[model samples]
Target: MILAELTIFPTSEGVSVSRYVKEAVKALEETGLKCESGAMSTTIEAPDLKSIFDAVERAHEAIVKMGAKRIHIDLHVDHRLD
Candidate 1:
């Protein structure tokens, strides 16, 4: 399993990005992965690396559809065989 944390945002969207962030969160949640929302980032647990990347892509696309040009993502992943 992989435990990951993702912090994504549109850099050109000004200081407050709650609206876009919420959309991304919704998209990710719809994936049915184990997830938790936090102030700075979101944490998710997935069966494999593919699952984690897929979810992040969905989140990114969600924001892009919201009129984002340049996007930034901070990701952390921990893979454990156990």
Candidate 2:
């Protein structure tokens, strides 16, 4: 199992980015992975690295589609074989 913490936002979007964050969450939810949203980041549980990456990509695309010129993504992953 893999647990990934993701923080995605637009650097060009100025101080307020709640709308973009909400779009990202919606995109992540569409991926069908388990997601827990927090104030700083969103935690996702997936079966493997590929799944996590794919979901993150979708989230990025969602934000891009919303007209963001520059996006920043912070991701931390925990992979456990046990």
Q: Whole-model Cα lDDT per candidate?
A: 0.97, 0.98
Task: Encode model 1's per-residue lDDT on 1-82: one tens digit a residue.
Answer: 8999999999999999999999999999999999999999999999999999999999999999999989999999999996
TM-score of structure candidate 2: 0.98
Candidate 1 ranges beyond 4 A from true positions: none
- 23: Cα error in model 1, Å: 0.4
Q: Which residue pairs clash within candidate 1?
A: none
User: Judged by lDDT, which candidate is best?
Assistant: 2
Which tens-of-lDDT digit does each residue in 13-63 have in candidate 2?
899999999999999999999999999999999999999999999999999
RMSD of 2: 0.5
TM-scores, all candidates, are 0.97, 0.98
Candidate 1 lDDT (Cα, 0 to 1) = 0.97
Clashes of each: 0, 0
Give the least accurate 10-residue stretch of model 1, judged by summed lDDT: 73-82
Cα RMSD for candidate 1? 0.6
